[model samples]
Target: MAFEIVRQECMKNPEGRSRPCNPEEICEVLENNQGSDAIQGISLDLSQVGDLQLSADVFRKMPNLMFLKFYSVGVKRSCSVKLPSGLESFSNSLSHLKILWNGVKNFGNLREINLAESKQLTALPDFSAAQNLKHVDLCGNIKSLKSENQLKSLAKLIVVGCYGLKEFSFSSDKITYLDLRPTSVEILDFSTGCMEKLQYLVLNCSRLKYLPINDICCMRRLQSLVLYDIGGLIDKSKLHSLFDALLSLKVIHLDGAFKLTDLPNNTKHLSRLRCLCVSNCKSLQSLSELPPSIEKLGAYECSSLRTLQLTSHFEPSSLADKKLLGPTLCYSVSYLRNLQRLTLKGCEQLYELPEFMDSLSSLSSLDLSESNVESLPASIKHLSNLKQNFLAGLKKTSFSARIAAIPRNC
Candidate 1:
């Protein structure tokens, strides 16, 4: 039942092997072989089938099936597709399920469900029978999802684009990752600090003005944090203190924050930090200090930044001007030897490059696209190990000569 016979000779020989078939062929096989206990999983792409007459009875007979997935691009607007029903009673073996851009409305009896970009999916059926369910991702406009007791085991839930979802509740301490990036939830009350186990939280709500800072601090294990494309709802003061509270944090991404002028004061203390991405902040003037352990740094489109400072961990003798050095180094990025990739795209007001731009011997990549820098220092030719240097669409093509002069010696 898993493979379809391609020719008449194949069907004539009962012991012959079969080959993989298209979605239409698989549907025919499912129709003829009603009770297939050996087929543990089935993945179908029904985008080309104009009118599919799929039925639930065909799947109900497969007692041992564990995985089910259906992918359709614009199926609701392009064609008619009938999905299986009574999936809530799917055999206990069912675990993983995914439906992408399809017209499926209800599904159950699975431990995980990843339904993304399906605009026609309005609801998720009851989960009372899906006791094994643990993770669900309905990231696009799901309107009808109800509460149930089976959520106790749920570990990860991402409902980012569900605009009609006002609020949803769960055991705050049990869930680890919760992403409400584009949901219509106006407010979230985390003052009780019940989400101690929460690690990754993404919020981009339009009406959310204040977040539970104390609750976020209570999440001792929280690591990766992303606050994307929201208005100035969160106080920059609270965000500044998060690095001190979340010692396990490694990545921090904040994009399109219109009110943030400065970041956390003690960024160098983040021992395990690896990546820092801050972009699209219209009012962010400059960064006073950066962590010493960072490997990837992106400061794209911060139009107001005029100066950047790196951690003062290098000896003064390594720099050309020892008298100009301050408690924290400014324009001394040459000492950030651990940095492998750096991007400063779209900062339109900057007119000069750092004097020690080429001292970063370990640096492998640099991007300065769409920036207003008027000249590149002659010392940029000192970057011996640089692999990728991007300078697309800059003013006057000043970096062209310095880029062409780099020695080809490996």
Candidate 2:
């Protein structure tokens, strides 16, 4: 009865039979390999009846399998194996189907899939014939697409850290690279039309609010935009024209946007921006209209921003957009001259440390943890390959006099 074997051609079901069998007479008697590390008995029931796990009696005897993979039980399985229904002739009988850790509900000629760490999966089935899927990694599942049309024929989907997803139905514009980072998505509605071939949009720590970006500008070939820890009701002035129609943006990451404050004015049209990261924006104060093809800038702990103006002191008048007062916010470190790596940890009203700092001299690596920094502005020795320097929550008498004048490469 069971005879499906793609690529090696055997398939014969709709009645025209060619049933044959013999995976050692329906698996269960093994020894040749001596129970390869026992995940179960008869060598995993003779590898689910020969050549890698496949149950339901291999559709009566090979129905045209192009490929079928099923490790079906690992992660210390005690019970996880009950997914083998007579797939409606699985897309004309298999092209490639991979089901692991069991629990899966059905099968389709999957294009490519990896249900890694299927922590007792929750939901995922009704796959409309997989429709030539491209790539899918249901990393550590807790499934929640409830059937967004069974993901309309995915292109590339990586649902990393899926904490019981609550929603994601922007349709499916042949997804380009949509990683709902560190998911727990609050409210994301990519304005319909199913994501018009989204380019690269990472919504990290999605606790979003009002993130429509004018419908994500219909993903006009979006380049890269990652927003992290997006806390409540976001409206950072439409985040600079919501990528001003993307025009192939470079890279922009607004980390831990704690109720973001401001950054709009079309952010100088991105102008092929390089990399700009506003970290832990504790109500970020200002950095208005930044756009000089920025080269990596990670504003640490924001702390109500203080100062950092380039392009000739960025004179945008009105008391330099006042409000930014304490917890120091870079009042000018030579305007991050091609900043390499700078993370002023927990800037606690930074205690003066920017005396004409040789324009970061392409600073290498610096993470002044929990600052209250007492001293160390000997121009930081112009960070020549500055190694690892983390002055952990200083105060020990200026932490040994700024850790002895930064020579250990900082």
Top TM-score hit: 1
Residue 234, candidate 1: Cα error in Å is 3.2
Cα distance off (Å), candidate 2, residue 155? 5.5
The lowest-lDDT stretch of 10 consecutive residues in candidate 2 is: 33-42
What's the lDDT for residue 341 in model 1? 86
Over 321-365, each residue of candidate 2 has an lDDT whose tens digit, in order, gives 334322223343244556576666675555545566555567676
Per-residue error at 78 for model 1, in Å?
41
lDDT of 1: 0.63
Give candidate 2 regions above 4 Å deviation: 1-128, 131-194, 197-217, 220-243, 247-313, 317-333, 337-362, 366-410
Local distance difference test values of all predictions, in order = 0.63, 0.56
Q: What is the overall TM-score of model 2 with all chains considered together?
A: 0.31
Give model 1's TM-score versus the native structure: 0.66
Per-residue lDDT of candidate 1, residues 6-96 (tens digit):
4332554321213224566556655554445555556667676665555445555564454566567865655544544423233322323
